[model samples]
Every structure is written in C-alpha cells, then in structure tokens.
Target: MKRIFTGGTILTMAENKQVEAVYVEDNVIKAVGTLAECREAAGSGYQTVDLNGRCMMPGFVDTHTHPMMLGMCRIWADLDYPKVAGIDDLIRVLKEHGKTLPAGEAIRGYAFDQRNFKERRHPTAADLDQVSTDVYVQIMHASGHCNVVNTKLLRAIGVTDETPDPPGGALGRDKDGKPNGQLFDSANDLLSGLDGVQPQNHGPNIHMPDSPDHLMQRFEVGQDFFVRAGITTVNEVQLTKQELNTYLRARDQGKLKMRMEMSFLSNYLDDVIALGFNSTFGDNWLTIGSIKFYSDASLLSGTANVSTGYLDSDRHEGYNYHEPEEMIEILVKAHKNRLHTLTHATGDGAVDPIIDAIEKAQAEDPWPEAIHRVEHAGLVTEEQAIRMGKLGMIPSTQPEFLYLYGDGVVDAIGEEKGREFMPMARFKKYCSLYTISSDAPVTTPNPMEAISTAVTRRTNEGTVLCPEQAITVEDGLKAYTIYAARTLRRSHIAGSIEVGKLADFAILSESPLDLKEDEIQRMRDIKVMETWLDGEKIYEKK
Candidate 1:
C-alpha cells in the first residue's frame, strides 16, 4: 500500500534535512520532498495521512537498556523517589508488599536510592529485618550494581562473615567485620543461591526468574514502555541465557514488537566463538550485536572505579571487575573473532583499562571499521577522549544520568569532576559520533527526557552540571536516532526517513526545535502523538 504523510515537519535526521511530506510504499520510504512531489511519487490509489501540524522523525533508538529487567521491575515494589522517602518509608512499603505475597516467595524491591533518603545510607539487614525476618527480602539499588538483603536471605545464600569477597565484587561489612547484607557487583551472584540465574562474574546478577508465562507478560509490559515513549529500537546490553530464551519465545509467539540488538554477556564469549557467531548472527528484529563486558561497577552506586576517592569515606573508591591484562586478553579474543564489544566503563579508572585493551586489540589485529563502545564513558579525560576518537570508539552514554543524579554525583565526586560528567560536547568534538541512551530501569526510557538533559545539562534541581558540555537539540535528537542506529550498524535500514529505509517513525505533539533555551525543560512535556513501525500505527495517544 502507498501512503503520503503530509502537514507535518518531517525531520529526516540526515544532515539537518526536513521535508514537507514523506512517501511510503510497502513499509519502506519511497520518497521525501515537497508535499506535491511526494503526492506525485505516490501516483494513484494512495492514502493521505494528515499529521495536523505535528513533528515527524525517526523513532528513537535506545542503544542500551534491559527490557526484561524493566518489566520485572514493574512487578517488584517500586521504591523510587516520592514513593519511599527514607528507610522508615522503605521498611513500611516492604512490609505492606510482604503482606500481599504468599509464603516461600522472595520479596524483591528495586529503584531505591540511598542518596534520597534522609539518613543518606543504605538500608542494612537490620533495617530490612524490620520488614520480615521469616522471608527473603532483597532491594536492588537504582544502579543495579548493588543489593541489600535481609539477614535471612544472607544466611540462605550462605554468605558468612568468613566468606571472603568475590573477585570483582565486594560485601559491605560492619565495624565488627561482619557482613552487613550489602552485596556489590559480582557479590550479587550470591543472591541466586544454587539454582537461580547466574551471570558468572561477567556482570551484576539481576536476572531472577519467574514463571514463563509471567516472564512473557513482563517482556510485553517492558516493550510498552519503549513504544509509548517513541522508541522503536533498543539494545539489550546485558543479554543472559534467560533473556535470550525470553526473546526467542517472544519472537516465536509473535509478541515482540521493538527492533532489538542483543549484546550477550562476556560469559558467553567462548561459546559464541565456538559457534562461529558474529554481530550479524540474527535477523533485523533480533540481531547479535556485541559481547558485553563490565570493566567496573556503576557510577550512581558510587562504585564505578574512579581514580580519586569519593568525598565520603564511607563510599570507598570503586574497584575494576578484571585486571588490566586479563581484560585486554578477553577483549583481544573477541576482537580477533571479529565480534564487536561493549564494555561498561563509567569512570576514568574503568575507562582507561578499556581504552588500553581496545588499543592493544587494534594494534594486534586491526579491524578499522570495528566500533568497540565504552558504555557510559561517564567520567573521561580529554586525553582519553582523544585516544578513543583515534580508535573510532563509540561513547554510548546516558544523559539522563545528569538529569536524575547530577546533584548526588557532585556530592559524591566533588564539584570539579562532577561538572565534567558525561561530557557529550567533548565527545562530539573528538569522536565521529556519540550516542545517548537511557540505561532504563535506571532512569526512564523516554528519549525526550534524555534530549532535554543533553541540551540543557540541567539536573532535577535545575542546576546545570556542565553547560559547556550541552549540545544542540538537533544533535541530541540525532544521538538518539541516527547515531544510535550507527552504533547498532542498522542506520541504512532504520535510522532516518530516507528512501529505502523502514517506515518507523515517531510523531510528536510539537517540534522540539521550537522550544527556546528557557523552555528546554518543557521538552519532557512534548508527548509522542503516535508511533509507527513497518508502516503500521503501533501506538497512538488516547
């Protein structure tokens, strides 16, 4: 079927291009130019879709998020701000939730940030014990890098005072040297016990299982979060066996809607290579894009391997997941096998080793087109940016971090370093392209929030962390659309509203470019009027 989209500002997202109308046929863009030209291209027997003065652009491509986890979070107790204000509120909320669960079921809560608490401290086992000592209670930090379990769960997991810290992860201890129920990074694996989902030591363990039917429901719920927010594509950056199975089930059942590029955990590196799997292993809807590695823990958790210590002594300097040589060896193996890599590195300390490994990998076996990404690349130096530019690395970062946690970051890292957080402008200067994403379930999956944060550099409290690092609104949109598509190597097929590209589009209530600097915060208020994929309207505002 042929359709001509008219009466809207069509943002092609290709070198600041805009058109009065877009001509589509059989789910692909056939032409884009003046309304008359598009109508002429459409010929007869075509449909006219009136946009009514809205703005049309490429659907957002969220390059990093955990859809399964995001869905699972929906079922868990939401402890995000304004929901639970402090430890007392957290305990009260958990107790209320505990009453609703049946016996033998673990009570899982997520999105609790201690920074928002009046006490400004993690809820220890003692605090969680107030909820229920009879059942297993675990609350995950907003960063997903840490978890605080009740004493019962600690004992159930067999983590004792004598149990030494796991390599690449740590157990928070009290003044008496006893485990305090705080598990960081690899230590989160202990929560899985003997039969639960284990990611090995590749990354944090958050893939707790549920019934297959319930998991499928969760996947669908998560997909809605993206589609409603104008995101048509996403990169599941931490794909585990369970997540892969879920995706397969969703695909086979015809329930999967969003275009997904899966980045399997490094734990599967050997198996992937043995199977001769590369980035092009799957179809457009579900492709194997990269091998994901964790160089360090999360920056928001105050555990992102920074060179300098945090201001608070209690928040110790973070540690790397692997030694420099070991990381280099692993990266080299993947690089040699012609597999793309995405390593989570949120601090200079974490970013440096990844830089070294990529440098070594390229020197050993050069793949000029290889775009190994530094996930987060949150706190990078100018020199490191220069090196990353030369290596053709993609700094896949989340600008929403600034909008949500900028003040807390400043409080943790101090003023100077915090001001340089994310540094999208510097990245634009050196790197060929930088992509912005919502590490969703961490912030929000809404691209408008990210774009607002990127262009304004404003925190939740309206403080500009680094105004110098702010990019133009158009650039921010490009980062979430075209640049992000490039990161997934799908720009030709999905990114822009150009000839021969898929008809995936997001229609907004107003053009974001029309918002003045002072009205930048209003960007988040711009609603996604409709979202289309494959020339079909998938979502429309009620």
Candidate 2:
C-alpha cells in the first residue's frame, strides 16, 4: 500500500544530502522532503505511520554474506575460538559435552580457529580421543575452509595414511604416514568425497543435501535478526543461479523482507554465460552481484598465501593456493562470461597476483563491463589499495572481524601488518570501497557495530588499532548504504531516499549522527523501530 511516514529525522544519503519525511507509493518512494511535502504527495488512500522522532536511513546493503550457512548456526557444538583457550581447555569443554551425550555419538563443532588461540595450533583427533574414543568428532575451524577429525571419523570416512591427498586438498598425515586428524583449507573439499557427517547421529551420519527449505529458513531467520538490528538489506555471497532463484521466490511470495543482492559462486560462471545474466538482472529486491572467487583462505588459517613464512612457524610458508596461471585462466573465463570476479584474498602475497589477473583481463578482449569487488580485502598493501580503487573494485569487509582479530593479527603478523587494517579513512578519501557482510555465523550482521568500529577504529578491547584509519560517522553511514548500493549496482533504484527510488529503509530508535563516540560503542542504544521494503512494512516493533 502507498504510505506516508512522518515525524522522523532522516539521513537521505542523496547526492544533495537532503533529509525529510517521505511518502511511499506502491513499491517506490513518491517523495522525500518536509513533512508537508510528503503528506501532500500522499493521496487519500495512503496510510501514514508515525516514526516518533526516530531516524530513517537507507537500508544497509551488505555486499558479502552466506545466508545458507546461517541455518547451521546453533546446529553444531559451538566451538567458537574465543570461548575456549588451550588444547586442554578445548578437551575439557568437549569432555564435558561428551559426558552429556550417549555413546558412539559425534561431538560436532564449527568455527574453532586455532589462530585465535595463544598457541596457534590446530585441535587434533588425539585431543578429542582423550575425551572419548566412541565420541568421533569433526570440528570446523573459524576460517570455514578447514576442519579436524578424530580417528574414528577418519576411519569411518575411509581416510587412511596411504590415501593419496585428493586433488586440491591434503589429508594432513604425520610421521610414519598416520593421519594427523588435522585438515587445512582445501582439506574439507577433499572430505566431500568421504563419508558424510551429520550433526549428532541424526540417522547414520549422512550429509544431507541443501534444499529450498534449508536455504529459505536461513534467509528467514537471518533476515529477521537483521531487521531487529535495523538492517534493511544484505548482499549474500556464494549463491548459484538456482539459489538465486530461491531468493527471488522468497521476494515474490512476500516472504523476504530484506532487500537482497547476491554474488554468484564462480563454480557456475559457465551457466551465467550461457544464461546471459547481467549484473542487475533482477529487481532491486534481489539483483546479481559480482562473481565470488577464493584465491586463498583467511589469515587465521596458515594457508592465506602470504609473502613471508609466518614468524611463528618456520616449516610452513603460506601457499598461494590459486596458482598464478590458474587464477589467470579462471579470471579470463569470468571476463569472457561478462561477470565481475569478487575474490576472497586476505594475505599480502595473494593480493598483487589477483590484481595482476584483473590487469590482464582489462588488457584482453571482451572484459566484463566493470572490474568490481574484492571480498575480505584484508592484509592488502597501500599500493594494492590504490590499484583496487583505480580499477573500481569494492572491498567488502567486516569491521567486527577487526574487533576480534585485531589483537591476534598484531601478535601473529606483527604490528606492521596489523597497522594496515581496513584503511577506512584512506578508502573513504581515495578508494571506492564499501562495507558488506561476511554473516550468520561468521559474525553478527549488525551495521551499527560496524558503524561504530568504522568511526572509532577501536579493536575489540577498546585498543585503537590504527587511529589514522577511522572514517567519519557520516561517511561510514554511506559505506553501508549508498556506497553499498553502488556495489550492488542498484544506485539509481534503491540506495537513497530519492523520489523515484524504492521505499526501502530502516527506522532506528537512536540517531547515530547525534550520538557521541562512547555512545555508539555501547551498541544497545542503536535499535530498530521498523523496517520497510518495497513500500510495504516488512517488520514492525511489537
């Protein structure tokens, strides 16, 4: 229904920087100016909702997220790295968990990165074995690219000492050719061939294939959580054309409230080419984003492909997992397919090479219209930042990551490496970077926490990582809104409170612009009163 929302402070994020009450007609914004102007624009049939002095801003457009993984959030034994400490602590926690379980059950846990630990060592099968032999287990590291398995799990999966390392992954065996119960980034990919493992013993430990219901539930729960935090949009990554269609179905059926933009997984670049899908193939509700690729794993896993061997481990040098030639081939393929490649490169050594591939694409024939997007563009050099901006690539980042990982980064990579950080001030002034999600179980999708961190540059413990990297709150707002719209290629349609734009925005209980430094850091003060998408009230505070 067409509506008028009045008596609210507004952050229009428009080119002219105007702020006012707005009138929504059907699915688009009919007007945004003074309250009188908005009321006048709305005819007799329109509904008026009072915003009660709350602030209205463009919906946050998260440029990178994994909506399906969110359904797996509380399903596993939550072995978050920050919760458990040493191996002993991990064992104790698992032993405690094992005691509560029946015999021969797997103690499954995800998001347990060893890099967050003081020792920076992987959790091994020996560790869980000490807890319970019958308690075969597999745990996902925080990087989401690796896992550790118990001997029983290995045996169940038919992984032997002599089992040749599968293509693109390692079995991680130790002396005398015994599987070490540890796996790296590509290791999970190899396990895809092994026996399926399910949460608990939910019937013979099968890996159930993801279905429409599985994905849709995640979208529902994930989107609900976002609306409560005043987020209006999320640009989810790791989607195929089929998955993309699922989200479209949600929008069409009126089940989806959050405005969505999705990045297609690079695995189906061929399908994208055959279908001839462009960047903005769908409506503002759900549009196609860049094609997501992973050059290497995150910094936490030693597989991040860094220039120097980590100072702590001499035997291990980060692998450039995406070989230069391989990267070139895939990148060239993406260019030919007319899809922008959004790569996840979180190490110093990986950045330049990926950029080189992009450079090659630009020089070659039939390059995609835009060379945009680098997901989790962490550990980048100043030169790379300059090069990325010049190339028009958006760096989708998670500030909450800085909140938790900042300390570990300094300890692992040294102060010099940690100092580079998100480079918010630098990006605001010099680059075309914007904020997106990296979500449900990776980190909270709250934009305000990101907004606070973006402005404060404060690490998790309130220690300032790089004071120079802080951007103003105003610009940070833009990063999550209009700049994000630019990332989704929906700038003209939904980013700002323009008259012709979609009536999609979030109503916040607290006006962040009016808050002080310490106030934003509190987080609880920033609350959502309501969320409207496509001129329809999708969520209302009960």
Candidate 3:
C-alpha cells in the first residue's frame, strides 16, 4: 500500500497521451488527474511524496534486451567502430587500449560497423597479434553473429585448425585452411570452455563473475541502469537452458527487479517442448515468452540477407544465418508445441520468405493469438507489412537502432533499400508495430534516449536517413511504455497508469515529451526520485 505521487506532469500513455499526477494503493494506480485530485483521493492515511513538478510516467518496457551483457561494460574491449574514420584508426584504437590489461589477457570489443571503416573488413587475429603477440583479443562485429579473435587468444582458448566446427556457428579460416581467428554464432562453444574468457578472479569461468550472491544482483544493477534511462521493461532475447535456470533461481529468491519477457533460443526447442511450456506461459515478472530463430546476421555486423549489396564493398553481400526450410521447420515445431515463435528478420528480401514460412506453418495449424514477432523487421515490403498485421504478427523493432544506425544503413544496404530503415509509420499503417529494448551489451537500454531518437529519427548531421518515417513524441513515448507491454502480452497488468495496473513508474526531472528534443538529450543522467515495482518502493535515487 502506497500514498501519493503528486505535482508531476504524468504521461499516462493510455488511450490519449494524457498527463497527470496519480494516487496509488494495493500496488496499483488508484487515480490519475491533477495533483489536488490525487491528494484529495489519497486522504491523510496515504503516505505523501511530492515530485516537485517533474515528469512521472509508466516505466519504459524494452521489448528486446540482454541484461547479462552489461558485464561487458567491465570485461570486454569495445572497438568504437562507428566513430572510427578508417582501418588505420581501428588499429590505433587496439594498440592504445591493449596496453593496460593483463599481459596474456585478450581484448574484446563490440559495436563496430564494416560500412563506416575505410578497410571495410573486420580485423582478424593476425591484425591484433601484430600489435601485441602476447595478448589474446576478440572484437565482436556489430552484427552480433560473429567476432574476430587474435591468434594468442584463440590458441589459448584451444581453437585449432583441426577442431571441428560447432553446430550453428562458424570458425573463420584463412589461406591453407588455417583458422583465421574469426568465429560466428559457433563462438559460444569456442569461448564457453575457455575459463580465461569468464575472468579467472570470479571463478573457473572468467567472463561471468562469481562473486555476486546471485544472478539477481546482475539483474538489479542492470535494471537501475535502465530506469535511469526511463526504460521500464525489456524483452530479453535468446536464453539457453542454463540461462533460463539462472533467471528462475534468481526470481525465486526475489532478485529480479524489472519486468522481463524472456525468449527461448530455437536450438533448445526440443528441451522446452519436452517440458510442455509455451509462449506467455508465466507470471508478471518472469515468463516463457517468444521462441527465437535467426533469419539474418545482425545489421551492425554488416550482414542482413538483403537482395541488394553493401554500399561499402561488392563482396560484402547481406546473408541469412538460417536456411529458409530450416526456419520454416522451426516455426512449424514451435507452433505445434503451442509456443509463440519470434525470429530475427531484417532485410526486405528476407521479409517475403520469413512471412511466407510463417504463413505456411499457420496455414496448416493456426495459432489463435499467436502473437509472433519479427525482430528488427527494418526493411519489410509494403505487402509484407500489411500481411503481418492481417496475420497478427508483431514487428519487434529497435527504434534506438534507427537513431544510431541510420547512417550505417545507407552504407550497408545501399540507398535504394537503405531508405527503408525502420519505416515505422508505413508499418504502423499496415502492421502491429511494437517497441522494446535491446540492451547492453548490445545497445543502451535507456528509454528516454529511445524516445528522443524515435521521434526525431536523428541521423548523422546533414543526413536524415528517413525523416518521413519519424513518429510523434507521444507515439515514441508509448512505443517504450504501453506498446512495449502489449508486445510482451503483459498489458493486462503493466503498461499504463490505471486502476489495477502495477504502480511501476519512474520519477524524472522534467517531462520528456514536453521538453525540446535538444533539451531531452541533455537531460541524460536524470535521477529517478523513486521506483515502485509491486506496490513497493524498490528503488529511490539516492
């Protein structure tokens, strides 16, 4: 039972993008209107807290995210690719950052785009080893499907030319069939066995620190980071069995603080089916969300399986990680098991087949409220967008990506198709558009930043990648809040500030939708005066 959140301009995001302060009780928003109305409704028994005329809104729900990757903030090396001018610049960055770590320790970095670099090629192990033969290092390409490691690092991890490649992953090799120290999705097996990668100080596994009492510690810290950015929930994509078990153990212990709709990796379909679980199969804080399958390489890593070629180079054509038939098979299996299926679909070319596959599976056995998702449905055809809406599929997109990668899209997908980047308006006209967070160690989990970007559709100076696609600030706000909740099928309880909805909201310095776009960006690091999850104050900015 709580009292009052008064004197703040609240963005309810319910029906209209209404503004008001609210009163709460029994862990739900009891009333919303002017401050006097809430205070009067609350009475003397209510615990009163004034917001001093700031913004109070439903916490943002990021539909796509990976919180564990936050450890990368402390552990891995980031190549800073988007900022680099050329290959020589990347080499310089590696040489500088490699000097401060343990001698044999590897350098790992993320967020590099081949389109922006002069070399237009990822740096391999030899490139890294040349600077420091003693150190082992790996740089994950922006695509997230692959990364390149140095010889020292790969050898130390025991990846050799003779080692057979792991399923669903690739070990990039060079002249004469020698491993070139580049690994794609298959890198999981290659890195998992290496205790060195998890961090020796934490435990046998060097990458995942062992000192935390439970995984919830990681979740909470990650949640705070998200709240500060105004993100209320996240669709944490791709969980393995062990990872799912960890989340369960943490939740049972009451460690998870934010709302999470976690997805299952397609590889584990058989195991999940044997257990008899399907999509939207759990409670408020945790649940068995969509099942994940890959359609294309990550957009940042420069492979999106498009019919067109990359603007940077002729050889660098886009590609899909999974075969069309195999993808259809996954959808069929998931549909049969009654689990909702969501895949990573990004290219215009991939759109037709991906949708066709979904249609094929559904045509035989329809999922009555399937609530399927297409991750990064960035460059979809007009017909495909319409079909998605008609068929009840959700386009789980990253608005933040449009803000960050708009320029890169032009270089990576060519001008003709590049203009198709996150054309949300057209999609909204034809499909059910949804927004969620894809976060660290991917993109940041900040909803305010996401809100600003979504509305502005900001790109590199002098270049508006798709200005016509820009959404209203109010719509952008909902994309992260209510729209996000709907994507997770959690709208019944969370999403907006209304009776019976959980009292989960963030206190901000000012209303984001009211402030000028430029001011909104400068409002970075704004404090959350308080955060309530289940009618309880779990976090209050110190």
lDDT winner: 1
lDDT of 3 by residue, 392-488 (tens): 7788777667766787777677787786688777666776656645545556666666656656676644366666776776777777778878878
Question: Which ranges in model 3 have alpha carbons more than 4 Å from their true place?
Answer: 34-41, 81-104, 156-178, 194-221, 515-530, 537-542
For every candidate in turn, the CA RMSD to the true structure comes to 1.2, 4.3, 4.5
TM-score against native, each model? 0.98, 0.89, 0.87
Better of 2 and 3 by TM-score: 2
Tens digits of per-residue lDDT for model 1 on 147-205? 99999999988988899998888899898999999998999888776776777568999
lDDT, candidate 2, 19-57, per-residue tens: 667888888888888878877878678787787888888
Cα deviation of 161, candidate 2, in Å: 1.4
Q: Which regions of candidate 1 deviate over 4 angstroms?
A: none
Per-structure clash totals for the candidates: 0, 1, 25
In model 3, state the lDDT of residue 142: 57
